[model samples]
Target chain A: MLGEINLEKVGISCFFLSYLVAFAFEVTRLIKKSRTSRALMLLFAVAGLCAHTIFLLVRSRAADLPPLVGSQLDWMLVLAWLMVLFFLVYSLLDESSALGIFFLPLVLLIVGSTYFVGQEPRAVMEGQHSLKMAHAALLVFGISGVVIGFVIGLMYLVQHRRLKRKHGQAGGLSMPSLAKLARWNRLSVMLSFPLLTAGMLTGVGLGLYSQRTPEPVQLLDPVILSYGVVWLVMAVLFGWLLRAKPTAGKQVAWLTIWGSGFLLLTMIGLQVLNMDSWHS
Target chain B: MNLQVVYCTHHGTDLTLREKLAFSDEQTARAYDHLRNEFPDSEFVVLSTCNRVELYTAQESAKNVPTHQQLAEFFAEFHKVPREELFDDLLERTGPDAVRHLFSVAAGIDSMVVGEPQIVAQVREAYATARDHRASGPLANAMFERALKVGKRIRTETGLSEGRISIASVAVGDFGKSIFDRFDDKRVLVIGAGEMAEETLRYLHAEGVRDVVVTNRSIERAKMLAGQWGGTTAPFDQLDELLGQADIIVSTTGASRPIVSCERFQEVRRQGDPKEVFILDLGAPRDFDPAIGEVDDNVFLYCIDDLEATCDQNRKVRKKEIAAAQRIIDEETDEFMQAVYHRATGPIIRNLREKWNEISQLELERLFGKLPDLNQEDRDHLEQCFNRMVNKLLHPPLEVLREEAREGTPHGLMDALKRLFHLRD
Candidate 1:
């Protein structure tokens, strides 16, 4: 009976339902801390991640391309998949931790956005295939880093507020120490910015290379302009982080949240609006 | 078996009264000597701390056991406390209640700060002192050893002592330790040598902090606190300089305005090596400006309100575990009482069995003398029959006595058995 079920027929709902159940288990931990609930959460997350991997594999095989460069929908799914990988690893290490409560909703949002985004395959020039793959891979990794930095920044702010309010870790919503959270937040930002900068530089190289081809890419496309603005914002944050004498942790956290959040929103919004010149 | 405890704890009396009733190590040793002289047959153990003073006594005989009033009188004489003042304040527990009380005390359920860890060590020390002074007997030793075990079981089985509840402890444990991995190498600067500052220093000192620089407006008070913690005193005028040098700052000044402003702290930060500094502001009228926390990433400034909030939350968590802890205490108390009651019947049971055996032997010897013409095998068979008859007759009464001991010592039944069997204590 299991073998009779076609893997291609498995859609977003299969893993979405699994993740929903996993998130519910995560909530139950706060109401009453139980190892059973923690175990169940892990089990469901792993199951969901397995289904997620299978879905990406099936899609990639059908499209005859890697999921990272398949299409906007596949790209978003890959991002969500990386986040699930992170959540699963962290939850397994610290079973009682509430990281899933913060991370799962964002994963769900990205996965859900894939429903509205275009799924048509993007055509690449035969000779430029390797460059496109590298560009997509770098951007995917960089964007995922941005997402992680955003989440960590948000966690830092929440932890800082709790410490400042002098509330004990309440409702089983235990967080890492503010110092540790701040350090991770800083690391996420510091690492993501360089990856994003390299990704942007590579995109510029691709754009210039395409200018000499029969179908030259438009530099003033709304998508390219918006991405450039987002990259510029990130660069500013990067400069401030380097020059500032260890800026207040809260300030760094807030700045990271805005910078990374803006980048994610712009990327998702442009894809959903179908205003991109390159991928479309 | 009799057990009694005359105590004044934070539950019934204030700290001042407990202080009056408290005994020093020297005083406790001397008191044990006096306790032995006054009640030669009784075993004694005295537990004295800032929160409570308890004297536990156990005796084999009821007539020689000290009364609650007698213990109160003894405390009055030994500690120089007035009888009228202490008589009403001292609470008494007897028998099972006494056992339950000690178990609860050792478990930290009866502490002023519920689930404080010091009480367990205090109880251990008290038992050890009694053992050293030769004031404890077998009964006292058994009770104390079981109490310590119960304390450990409670800690393992419940989340009673999971969180630190005091302001000083919460500040250090929740925030300070999170900032710095080790305290021994950190330079600590304590501002304003007051009670709160001293308490915070005590926790820091316990965390391996040695190079303490105490600065206060009152030089004498600074010197006193510095001397207590084996720290050196810095001049009050050099607070800025001290702030620049220290890695951890504990400030509890009673100043009206903010002592450390954002701008002033900025100057301090500029001069110092860029390292993490944890500032515990324990003042009510807020010594450091709240904005100072936002001054830089390395500065972690927390006031009393912040620490108190964590303490309050921890107290609530501990309070939730009390029912579970109490259940353990109840089960253990019942088991202990049954054992004590069973022990109370041991000698009587032995005596009754011995008396019956002796009577059977005497009867068999007489029968043998009267029936000397019987065969050797027949005489052996007769002796076996006589022994069986004696055992069968003794079984039912002894079984009933053992059953009664399970609930409690069957005093009336025991008395009847003693009279009928002519048993001695």
Candidate 2:
């Protein structure tokens, strides 16, 4: 029965539209902060996340694989799912923290990118398949960390700018304080770098284990090299964050934005654009 | 029959004059006594707060209500202020306008800091005081009870009192809290023993700040302020040392020049590892140089004008709620006035009913005497029928009189009815 599952009703467009409307409501909330708009924003976000989860499940059933291991398209959608999930949970905790303004756009971007990305599942090595799954899973969770870091960095910058400009707290828009944002930003960088590092080590181990397979994974693979570059970028960010003073919130926020932004663009561009990667 | 408010508020009066006119607890009692003596027939409720001094009076007879000038003279005589000095600032509102003004004041839109909650309590206290003094009557009771209800409705139904608007509150709540997550352990350095500093300290203390070090040229004053806050004081000469250690600084002084220059602040920063420090310069002339804010990323220096800009913006946002609140106030005012006017017609209405009943009774008596052989049951039945007919006859004109009273007192219609029916007042 699970093998016979079909996606006749749900699709990426369903959640995409929900997220788009949520983002619209969030933008409207910026102009006029009201509980109605804030509630609408959360409602749509939760709806989008629900549809997003169903969409992933339907695709997973169709592919006979988990969404993270299904394809680049499924992978990106899963990333968006995590983001929308984060937004829904955090927004519940803080009814109106202006988080949707920073979060929903990223979700929309990731979900929208799935349309252009590859939907066909990658060819898995029959013997080392679980290792490959582990590799993809770590990278997925690592990228989630970076996405959150990017969002927190954006919030920090916004709050810092608001304070420096001496604007009164806007009526409906309440962002996290610069102090809290800075702390979250630092934690994201610290936590994500190790996740990405462990992910890199697992991918290397997976490649090394693939020597017994028919198509032995290459050392100079584009997938490996591209990800290696991302790791280097994250490593530098991680190193800088550790040495930076706690007082340097604005600078830390800027660096996190840059690091996380670069990581997202490179990873998304490689998969969606079908850039010359050995995995494809 | 009439409601009038003679108010001298922060809106139009000089602050110094308001201070002089403000009623202490004893002064309020004395004023109530004088008001009772001067106007024996009037109902008076005095609402005296730091922002306003208002005498609200409700009179049973509109014809003999005290004039605005008389109230102004009363204020002058009681406070010993000159007549000319107090008269121009004393404004008057009567009828529905007076009711609307009271509603607005109770709801806090008319306060110096719009939507401040303190005014509601102050208004409530005034009403309670008036009742305690045996000054408040039925009309006063109705007005104040409804005013408090209006205040609560406005507060709940609208976002009037949602955010902080005062300078010290805004400084500590919005700006300070945004910069620091916890305040209990944050070392607070207060430079100068001024009101703004104390106010800011109050907000900080509420935020759980315990370590407060006050420094001023007058070390004795600094010690006094520190003692009140459960902290210690430092000499003015140690301000530079204090600056290096403080995580938060609030300065307000009468100095002619900047107390902390950029170079001097830089020297202090160099004495220790530069950390996040929030500085509030609340002085008119600015005790800290503006350039000190630009010294480093760790130093957040805000002056009076900067915080005022935010306060002004917040105040403008609150002003938008005025229209929303006014809609409620307008509806309430009309309803209250109509009720007052309807109450005004109470005696005439009773008299009209009585006059018609007397005429009907006399005619019934004549008919019963002529038909003396009629049984008691038949006679009662006839009388019941006759009474129903009289009520049916009076219904149209009486209903008209009641309807007219809703729009206003209906003085002309009442007089006309009295003349036509030969009804006594």
Candidate 3:
């Protein structure tokens, strides 16, 4: 019975259902933890990851392009894939950490948003393959870092509130120390800002270079315009962070949350509206 | 089945009495020798700590199990206390109860400060010392090995061992650690040289805070506190300057009013290295002004009431986990007891099976001789039938014996089996 189901037929629904179940199990642990529930949670998460990998590979094979350049749907899935990888790594390293609860909902939304986004492949201009690759890779990584920072910020706030209230650590809700969270949050923003800026610069070069080509990227399109706004917000936050004094951990956490959260929301909201994205 | 424990823990005994009863390393060797002489057939392990002094002993035979009175007399003799006075203080448990008590102690549920990890190391070291002295046997080794695992299991599974309970520990662990990453690079300024200051200093030293400065009105007391902690002493009048220079301040001074007001702290902050400061006001009268907690974003201040409340919450948290921990201990205790009972019944059961199988083999050889004319297949079939019949007949008695062993050593059933089969030891 198990062997009858073919791996080649794996689809988004396959992994999507697995992740949905895995998320449910994770919630069960928070409500009432047991060894069995934790085991099931890990099992479903691993199964979902395997299915997700297979689906991505199969879809890339069908499209004759890498998932990053396949479409907006593929782009969102790739983002979710990176985050799921991070979530699994974090959850595996620390069994008691509450990363799954905060991380999974975001991953689910990112993956779920793929259904609403366009599947038309993005453009890869002549003689600019490497630049497009670099742009795609850098932005994917930078966005991943932003998502990680946002998650860590949320955790910092939760732990900070619990500490401020003088509450003992609740079972199955283990969080990192505020100092460690703050340090990671700082590094994520610091590292991702440079990558994002480089990605945006490469994108601009591609757009300017495309002016002489047959199909030029829509530089002032709604997608690009909204992305620019998000980038501006991040730039402001990064500048302030660099110039600011050693502020309290709570303030830093809030800033990271709002800054990263805004960038993600604008990108997703624009893609969901089916605006004329630059690559389309 | 022969295991026993006689102990006086902080739960029931006075601190003075426990201090007198606690065995030092030098005394433990001598005590082991004395116990060996008194009970040559028994395995012994002596666990001596500030909060508890337990004597875990087991014997190979139930008949050799030492009496409670004899063990009480031993403690009285060893401690040089009068027998009658020490007898009532020392409580005793035998068999399953004794195993449960050890598991509880190992898991930290029985600790005065529930969830303190020091007891696990203390128990491990005690067992190792007993092994070194050739005092521990297989039963004691099995119990202690399982006990260490039980401690780890309980710690991982339940929140019984989570969070810090003491005021000093909470101040350093809950708040101080949250603000600063490491302490070795930070300067520690301890005010007043009181007991609370000393305790907090000990925790800080453990966290690698080496640069310590103690100040007080009496230079002598300050010098003593500084000397004990390998730090320097500052004059009390230099409090403002010291406050500015130090990154972490623990003020336990018994002052009538707030020594470091918010205005004074802000003024001092200007001269200070503009870095984060952690102030733990462990003083009863609220030294360093509660208002200073909100004065600067970099300044994290916690007073006595704040730390005390956290400690109380920590205690309540530990109390809530006791039920969970007790469940684990109960389950492990039953499992351990069942294994012990099976170990006790092992030799008898093995001999019975071997003896009965020997009779079956001999009878089969005779029957084959009588049926020499039969075909090979027929003879083989008969032999299989006989073997099956022997196993089927023995199954019921063996099942009964195993069931009986789960509760305890099935001594009566084993004796009856030996007699009925005319078996030798």
Clash pairs, candidate 3, are none
Residue-wise lDDT of candidate 2 within A10-85, one digit each (tens)? 7888889999998898888776667788888888888878878888887787789888778888888888887787
Kindly state the number of residue pairs that clash in model 1.
Answer: 0
- Listed in order, each prediction's TM-score against the native is 0.73, 0.83, 0.85
* CAPRI accuracy category, model 2: acceptable
Alpha-carbon lDDT, every model: 0.86, 0.86, 0.86
lDDT of 3: 0.86
Q: Across residues B1-425, which tens digit of lDDT does each residue of candidate 3 receive?
A: 59999999999999998998999999999999999998898999999999999999999686657899998888888889888887889999989999999999999999988988999999999999999999999999999999999999999898787778888888887777766778899899999988999999999999999999999998999999999989999888888899999989999888988888889888888777657788989887888877776666567778888787888877887888899999999999999999999888788878888887889899989988887898989988988998898899888988899999999998898889889988777
Ranked by DockQ, the better of candidates 1 and 3 is 3
In candidate 3, how many Å is residue B93 off?
2.3
Best by TM-score: 3
Could you tell me the lDDT of residue A11 within candidate 3?
77
lDDT by residue (tens digit), candidate 2, B295-373? 8876778888888888887787788888888898998889888888999889888998898899999999999999999
* Candidate 1 structure quality by residue, lDDT tens digits, B171-265: 88778765655788989999998798899888999999999999998899999999999899988889899999998898888899988899999
CAPRI-style grade of the A/B interface in model 3: acceptable
TM-score of 3: 0.85
- Which parts of model 2 have CA positions greater than 4 angstroms off? A1-8, A121-134, A208-219, A276-280, B14-22, B27-43, B59-90, B131-138, B152-166, B320-324, B335-406, B409-425
| Candidate 2 reference-contact recovery | 0.50
